[model samples]
Target chain A: MNTAAALSIGVFLFTYALIISERVHRTVAALFGAAVIVALKVVPWERLPEYLDLGTLLLLISMMIIVNIAKESGLFEYLAIKTAKLAKGSPMRVLILFSVVTAVVSSVLDNVTTVLLLTPMLLYITRLMGVNPVPYLLAEIFASNIGGTATLIGDPPNIMIASAAKLSFLEFLSNMGPIAAVDLVLTVGIIYLAYRGSITVSEGERRGIEAAIENLDENEVIRDRELFRKSVAVILGVIAFFFIHDRLELPPAVVAMAGASVLLIWSGVEPTEVLEKVEWTAIFFFAGLFIIVGALVETGVIDGVAQWLLGYVSDTGQALVIVTWFSAVASAIVDNIPLTAAMIPLIKAMGSSMNVYPLWWALSLGACLGGNGTAIGASANVVVIGIADREGIRITFLDFLKVGAVIMVLTVAAGMGILWLRYVGV
Target chain B: MSIFRSLIDRKFRSIAGDRYDEIVKRYREFLLLPEEFVLPEVESILIPLDRFSGDFHGVLDVLEAYRGAKVRLVYLLDAQTFRLIEETLGEEEAQKLLQVERERGKRLVEALKESLEGFGLEVQAEERFGDKGDDVIEMASEYDLLVISRSFGSEVTKTSPISPVVLKVVQHVLVPVIVY
Candidate 1:
């Protein structure tokens, strides 16, 4: 490699190290790296925006606005409380309901938002039910990542992949949906097996807690009934339109933005307030990370890495397995968003020899599922940990990895098996 | 007949005519209704919201007993605490932390309001920034009664079933206090 390629690798590794070490805010670390690259002329200043994926950025922002309105209306909380009531204070039932709802919600909304909205309410329910919230919270983190794999808007990595590959929303759902569906069920089963002992309550205690919660009128949390109704209608419409966006020749970002606008006008919420609620840290992080990844691409570092890795696998089947495990392990070690961003171009560089479509699926499955391996593996995991810390609940890294690593391995293995059978020979 | 009967026959018939039976029927129906379904004689209730402690259910039970009473829930945001957090974390971080507390307060008030509504009470939520105990005690005079929770805080003791704020409220408020 040349001097520029070596320097690029050094910059990338240092920035990544800072992010992983948690010594500085991940966003700040990424932005620092982006600044360094631009100052060093690794990537030209004027071409910075070209490196940033505006489609993914716009998609994230629009969806955040839409979901923020739903949250402000207390729709998600209302749904969660309803789910809890359905569980009737049984700890096992509570875990099931929460994981299912969180997974389902993450399929449409972003994982971090799904986890954020659910974590507080889950903690409260666990308190009322006399159970520890950590296990349920961990289950939710896993569910969110798994569920996110099923949809384009569910996770940052999926959005990046969709944006980069020019794949439609329907394409992602069609290819990734089946395995994600199976993985979600397997995830719930594994979590139940692992946490069932701690989540148990006596029959009488369960009934008492159930009776207490039955009195909570979920309707009471609705600040605006009219706004809630309007948001639901708009969201339904958005989902319906998402299915046909490709046929209609529209981008998913446009569809989401249109839905957001409709909600804004219908709900009469202040645009500024809704915007403030958006996770701008995530947005900036994506923007800066894209530029750094672009620098790696410009210097042929990704190509070199891709070519070197390809030297080990001769056939498509071997490539599929290798890519899945590599992505999974790498994603578990680092933030999946950055890992996926850096790998997308690398995968595209290998597009000439294999069916790029299956590789995309493999990467999507690995990166998304791998997030459950460690606390820092996914944004959702980090956010959930932060919420727990604020409540004086300390979830140690090893504590998460002990359970998460198992689920990650199981789901990633399940994903590889499914891909092998469906795309390759058994 | 007595003079009253004679007066009723002559004066009351002229005013009532044939509509008197319908009016009397309506009056009887009103009296036959359950007491809880009837509107309360009292005007409104004042609740001193201590951020840290309250049996939400018990408070609602008290409100249930006064069916149809208007409720005013006062949540005092302590400015001193906000300033302290600001000093330590700077403006943006402080605001974020305060925003979380504000959300918690709002949610608590809303939950109470909903429970009160379930009991047919008209509810109003008020947020003030000051010493919580002093504000609640001062504001208790505006309403007919003060209904506060007996559970003092997240951490409770038998010596203090009621929070210090509730204790101050009980000592100084002009209205009768109902400690749930």
Candidate 2:
């Protein structure tokens, strides 16, 4: 290997270690790695923008801003209360309804944000009904990952794939949406059956909880009705634009940015206030990762790996399975964002020798769904688990893995089957 | 006294010119009058209760010490708990939960008032939302004595340390306190 390739690989592996070990903040580790690469001239400073993938960054930032502003309007809380009330205090019904809402919301928003907004309220409702929240929380975690798989912008990995592969929103929805829907239903059903005994409440307690929920006023949760109306209108408009952005010859990033800008002005919210809430750490982490991964691409390390993989597995269907299962297991061990970041270039390099379109679907399915395999597998899992811990409800790593590993295997297998039928035709 | 001291200090500053600060420092204790300390004649009593506090009946014997003292029963709806909810959920959900807690606090205070009044003591009740320790300390100044349970701020077992809120009130409040 050349000096630059060795240096790039060293920096990338070291940074990946730091991120997974959480010895230092992931953002700091990534930025430090990116800095080392640029300082050493592994990837020239001038070409940094080339690897940054401005579309993915912009899309992430815009969605964050939109979600932050929308959250202030009390829309998410309103939806949660409304859903809980709709369940009418039935633990099984509540579990199913919340899981479905979490999936649909996570598909539209990001999984971490969706869970952060929903879990506390879910805890409150379950506590009121005198049922365990662990099963519900687990179901939502699986549902969020599954739901986030359905759209181009649903999960960070999917967003990165769409940006790199130049796949349109409609393509992602049509390809991954069906499998995600199926997985969500199956995961929710499995969770309900597995934890039904724990979630079950007596008839008297159910009736009392029903009365309590009935007394809750969903409308009272809306802090600003006008802002709520504007946010909903803009979000709906954004979704509509996402569907037809391809026809309009616009990228998903542009659609998202336009929506975010319009909402900022239309809502009359201070720019700094909304901007302050943006997850800059995640954004910078992505920027640094792009540069780090770009170094591997520039040094031809990825190309060598791709060549080796192609020589080892000449059959396209077998390659699809390898990529899918590998992405799933690897994502389960580390943050999917970095895992997907490293894989994007390798997959692109392999595309030259064979049809790699199905590889993209496999990567998305494996990386996104694989996050459910462990407690530390995804940002959403860590966030929900942390929230649960703070409330004195311990969801140990083993407890999560027992359920998460099974769901990850099931969902990834389902995704693999769908990909095989769609692209492999067998 | 403060106003009079300020006038005297100004006059002294004019006479002593730049030497005023040095003179005040040398005789600071004499210059600043010492506050008079007197035994508190307990007439009005402030009792702060959280949901986990022991029943008022457990403290009735203590209350009988200050016979005919007006009792103010204040139920504290802990702001910290609601803030945690807000941090995890959104502000709207926290507000809704706070409102529910406030209503529950009101009901608790009202029930306690009726029972306390039955003992031939005047009783007034109010519900407040704030940090339990800070609120108890702040409210204790209005009454001659503070009556709080050892489990005022949090649930405790016999082996647990005294409640932090009760400890804080004991340390800071100028009024006499009865920690039952």
Candidate 3:
């Protein structure tokens, strides 16, 4: 490698080490890396904008604003409470319904938000039922990753994949949805089986809890009828546009921003308040990441890495397996967002020389599913664990791994098989 | 395409240029109350509605002990629970619950007021939406003393004697807490 390549590679490794070590905030680490790259003139300062993925940033901001508005309108809590009511105090039903609901919501809104909305209400219901909420919380986390794996906008990794691969919303659904649906069912079932005999609520207690829930006025949850209607309308309109954005020759970012604008106009919520709710830390982190990754692309380091991987794979099936397992395992160790960001360029470089369409699906499945391996594997897991900790329910890494590791392995293995059959064999 | 690029480009630059920690700190500061308001003198006692057993008349013994101390009755509908209900049921239902909770608080206040008529103690009723523990803590600073009964909603129950929230409130607040 030449001087620029060596320097670029060194900076990239240093950034990754800092991020993985948790020594400094990720945003800080990423910013330092990006600043170093720019200062070194690896990519000219004027070309900084060219390097950043504007599409991804815009989509994230717009989505954040939309979700924040929905949150303010209390849409998420409404859904979770409605789903909890369906359980009617049965421990087994609570686990199943909550897991399924979490997964489905994660598919639409993002896993972290889903967990944030669900955990408190789930705990409340579980407490009322006189059951430990640990199992229910864990199942929700697992289901979130599984459910988010199915769609383009569900998980950060999938969003990165869509932006990088130019994949459409429908394409993501067609490729990964069926397998993710199956994984969610299996996940809920596994969680139920593991905790079924442990929950010892008596028939009398169950009936008592059920009666308490029946007395709860569900309609009392709505804080504002007009805002809820408006928020729901905007969200539904955004979803509809996501389906046909390609046909309209509109970018996903455009559709998202337009939806956000319409909501702002309709709701009359202050722009600053909406902007304050945006996850600027993640956005900034992504900006720095894109710069670093762009440096790698400019230096041909990604191509080198891609060539190294391609040399090992004899056929498409082996490539699919390797990518899926590699991504899954890597994602378990590090957060899937940055992992996906770094891998996108390499995957693209690999695809240029051969038909590697299946690899995208494999990467999506692995990165998202792998997030269930440990408490820190994904944003959703970490947030859920944090909430549990704050609420005086401690979940250690080993405690999470005992459940998460099993689910991660099973789901990833199944994902590889699905990719092999659907993409490669077909 | 260029206009879109420039617009996004401006955003990306700003995102990179901005300090997240500083922004978050500013936002946190913005969220805090502008300035602390001076609390009223500690001549009254504060009690949560649910803490009283057998409705408002349940605190008769404590009222008899205090003699001339005024009473402030607070009935809380958990803000988190209220928001959850509001989202699921609609505004109409949420309003009804608020009305119901308020009505319940008023009745409790009235009963206490009737019982304490000869004692020359003032009676006040309030319906709040939030964590009862937090509401109690915030109110504790202003009260001379808090007379409360341990209830099911308390984090520290008979089983878990040192409840997380109640204990924290006791530790943080300057006022004395008398648990019945």
DockQ of each: 0.02, 0.02, 0.03
Worst 10 residues of 1 chain B by lDDT: B26-35
Candidate 1: TM-score, chain B only: 0.68
Pairing residues by index, what is the TM-score of model 2?
Answer: 0.74
Candidate RMSDs in Å, in order, are 20.9, 19.2, 15.5
Largest DockQ belongs to which candidate?
A: 3
Where is model 1 chain A poorest over a 10-residue stretch in terms of lDDT?
Answer: A382-391
Badly placed stretches (over 4 Å) of model 1 are: A1-7, A389-394, B1-180
- In terms of docking quality, model 1 is incorrect
Which parts of model 3 have CA positions greater than 4 angstroms off?
A: B1-180
Per-candidate Cα lDDT values, in order, are: 0.80, 0.85, 0.78
Clashing pairs in 2: none
Model 3 chain A — which ten-residue stretch has the worst lDDT?
A214-223
Candidates by TM-score, descending order: 2, 3, 1
Give the lDDT of residue A376 in candidate 1. 69
Can you write out model 1's per-residue Cα lDDT over A1-426, one digit (the tens) per residue?
877777778889998999877678778999999888988998888988889999999999999899878766668768877887999989988888888888889999888667766776687678877787888988899989998999988888899999999899888888888888889789889878877789899999888878877767788777689888998999999999989999999889999999999999988999999998787878999998998899988899988887887787677788888779989999887778888988899889887666767888889999999988987677677777766765777777788889999999999999889888888976
Each candidate's TM vs. the true structure?
0.71, 0.74, 0.73
Which candidate number has the best lDDT? 2
